[model samples]
Target: MPRPLWTGAISFGLVTIPVKVVSATEDHSIHFRQVHLEDMGRVRTKKVCELDGQALSQDEIGKGYELSKEQTVPITDEELDQMPLPTAKAIEIVSFVDAESIDPIRISDSYYLATDGQVAAKPYTLLRKALERSDKVAIAKFAWHNRERLGLLRVREGAIVLHSMRWPDEIRSPESLAPRKVELDEGEIERAVQLTDTMALDTITGFRDAYRDALEKLLTAKSEGKELPEPAEGGEREQGQVLDLMAALNASVAAAKESRGEAGGGEATVHEMRPSKKATAQKTASRKKSTAQKTTAKKTAEVKKTTAGRKRTARKQSAS
Candidate 1:
């Protein structure tokens, strides 16, 4: 089992469930240290006082808030600990809300809340069951790292998980980042929807960090004094080429269907653009001209046939 990062109690109404907080995720990324190029000696950073130019130990460092260019106020851990924070020792559930109502962007780090002792088993199970049945998540407030933070509590895989959240004021408005008004036809919207549907999956468990895998391979080759592996071929798009929106969507849909081993003959076909007003008017004028020519040819043929019949009847009457 992993070591717990914190020990606290879940403050649910009048019930207190003692719990231990452990990280829900782990990093598998490879890290490197800075080193001198000539001797490969590790290069390390030293914390030094700016005024005296003296290197300091970790214990000598303390938190401080800057007031002005020449002024700063030093703060001690003891003073911060003694502050009036009700949620210091507990994960206080302020309210419960629908899980779907929470904005995903505001949530950050996640930790698993496990029962601290046998006495906590009953209340912990009760809270988990209540959350599961109601299908709601708990909004909470807790103090960590010398500051109070907004949190979200929800049950995941039969265990309570606390997700740290950004405060409402901490989230920046996205209005300035939005693009200016642009018009799109229904065909484009429908094609985009079709592409999304084609790319839909029930879960995203199959993906892996390709860059990390390549880095590991490169490191292994270098350490073993072997030839490095070359990158795979034919996986690049044409850079700087302007693409039609509808055409791109159609290609994406086709590619997605092909990846899933589905037939892309008919379903992924591109939409034909509608005729423009000028083209429609030209077609109308051409049809009218052709109709008038056909009418003139029919009238001339009838007149010729009528004159031939009149001459033949007159000759027959004169011969009689």
Candidate 2:
């Protein structure tokens, strides 16, 4: 098993469950090093003191809290170590709340809380089962990495999962997101619902990241000194402006139905198809007319150029 980052007790009422916290997620993102283009040299960074104009050693560095623009309070390692915090060595359960009541936006990193020892196993299992039965999560506070953090404790797949949560004031209000509200029509809403239903998935098992796969393939080809493959096409979608909202929704529903192998039967589907087909034909005709106009303009410019050249030669001959 992987080593735990923290070891503490989950304090609830008179009961305490000794637990160890381990990070649940792994970093899978591809990382690159900054190198000089000329010689592929690795870059290095150094910390320098602005007041002294000298590079300082790690031991000389100290933490400071900014008081004002011209002042700062220098805090030492001894002072920070001696600072008092109630939840320093304990995960104190402050309250229990409905799982759904906690806003997901407030959640940050996740960790798994495992029993610290054989003696802690029973209490850990008990708390996990209780949380599962109540369908609620425990809101707790604990000090980790020198800072107190608010966290959520819940049962996931018979294991205790801890989620570090942001402070209540951290979430921003959504008022700035909306410029104005628009009215909705019942028929249009119904058609949108139909489209959503047709495209809905029962599970997330089929979800795939095509970009990640393609990147990995590209790296493999580069490393093997093989020919880089051309990108696969046909992913573009028609991004037409919605001139008629109802017609657009109806067409969307029809297309979704076709994808799901459903027959586009009924009078409503046929009516929807007619307006879209007419709009497409009109667009095509407009494009063709624009292309023809451009071609005619190009021919006219060529004819004018040729006539000017002939007139210039005749003038030269008359002058001679």
Listed in order, each prediction's TM-score against the native is 0.81, 0.78
Across 1-320, the per-residue lDDT of candidate 2 in tens digits comes to: 67999998999878999999999998766667888999989987789998888998899898999999899999886776578877988999999999889989999999999998899999898898889888899999988877889999998888899999999988899998976888889998888898889889899888877777888889999999999979897464445555678877777777777777888823254334344555889999999999999999999999999999999999999999
- Candidate no. 2 TM-score: 0.78
Q: Model 1: C-alpha RMSD to truth? A: 14.7
lDDT score for residue 14 of model 1: 97
Reference-based lDDT, each prediction:
0.90, 0.86
Model 2 segments more than 4 A misplaced = 232-241, 258-320
Highest lDDT model number: 1
Please give the lDDT score at residue 221 for candidate 1: 100
